[model samples]
Target: MESKSKNAPAKLHLRSGDTVKVISGNAKGETGVVKKILVDKLRATVEGVNMITKHVKPNAQNPQGSIEKLEGSIHISNLQVVDPKTGEPTRTGRKLNDKGKLQRFAKKSGNFI
Candidate 1:
């Protein structure tokens, strides 16, 4: 007998180009734009936050091995959307306006995020 599996698509809450702040972590209070989202891992890569130094080995790509600073994946829960108008961390929610267009707004700023 064949069984039908029920699964839903992974939703990356923070999309690329969205501004966000590190809610709780070593990088707390730091804010940056969302660069990439890891759907499988439920993490997002925020620019200028969670900076980590990575060591590089001698390879064709890099003749000299050196330490490089790059962003590390942060759990989605550790991130909060930042409102452009108020410059505060806010929760994102969608609403259908009078024009029937879906828009994302910030709960704190009461403005489009």
Candidate 2:
């Protein structure tokens, strides 16, 4: 069964460059900057979190095989945006700014994020 907007992408609360905290899972309590948001998958890649190792074959740059550490994507449900003012994880809300444009704000501090 298809919904009304089958082609529409899922809405994600995260955006690239936003500081976020991992609230659950192996990396729980870890904080990092959002590197990318997988809207279709509802997952986000946070820097320095969810470390994964990849075996890289020998290449021109390196004669020996190497192991690489990379940040793995985590589901959005396990992450929360950190409030800029308080430097703490806080829930977000949309509100109209003074210019009448929609903007995201930190609900905990009542300040624009």
Candidate 3:
């Protein structure tokens, strides 16, 4: 179910455009940029990670059936944002920056991410 509240606490920390690491499953330790976030499903698709093969049936674009490989959605809990300063995976937290705006910070290096 979707949270109707705009101020609802974040249940997942990963976001699109973030460089994230796969912490578990088949893609463990692999890192990639987050391509998209499926908010309702609490999953994120990371570029070049968790790849899955799909059989595309004949369509307007594809005259003949073709096989394709693409990124697959991964549970948010399996992802961790890479620390900007240290280039390592770390837990993230929301905090006020120098500008007094809430931003994500790496717990390992204490750097704004």
Candidate 4:
């Protein structure tokens, strides 16, 4: 029953496998590869960032109940893609490449991300 913002883009500029840095929060300054994007919640799970523990009940896969540590989702606003060329966090921008295809680039280094 909730509606998304009309000004928000349908898709996030980030994708899986992209290296990103946490801009704010307890995990600030930590950089890691993006593991997954949760478009519905505008959150992304970065490797080794925002880790949390979960209690799991006994299941077929694991006969005994266990505690598991896993990466938790961080708000998209708290993440910035790391510029491959500059090795720094940078804002993302879109541009047309030689093939006239829209590609994401790092604003800081002006290089394709």
The whole-model lDDT of each prediction reads 0.84, 0.90, 0.90, 0.90
Q: Which stretches of candidate 1 lie over 4 Å from their true place?
A: 1-6
Error of 4 at 16 (Å): 1.2
| Candidate closer to the true structure by lDDT (higher is better), 1 or 2 | 2
- For candidate 4, the lDDT comes to 0.90
> What order do you get sorting by TM-score, best first?
2, 4, 3, 1
Q: Which ten residues in a row have the lowest lDDT in candidate 2?
A: 3-12
Candidate 4, residue 17: how far the Cα is off, in Å: 1.1
- Write one digit per residue (lDDT tens) for candidate 1, span 1-113: 53222255464457889999898989998999999987766788998889899999989988998999999999989998888998888888888877999888888777865
- lDDT of each residue in 1-113, candidate 4, tens digit only: 54664455466878889999998999999999999998878889999999999999998989998999999999999999899998899999899999999999999889987
Per-residue C-alpha lDDT of model 2 across residues 1-113, encoded as one tens digit per residue: 87533689865567899999999999999999998988767889999999999999998889898999998999999999999999999998889999999889999999998
Top candidate on TM-score is: 2
Q: In terms of TM-score, which candidate is stronger, 2 or 4?
A: 2
Query: What residue pairs are clashing in model 4?
Result: none
For model 4, what is the alpha-carbon lDDT of residue 49? 94
Who is ahead in lDDT, 1 or 3?
A: 3
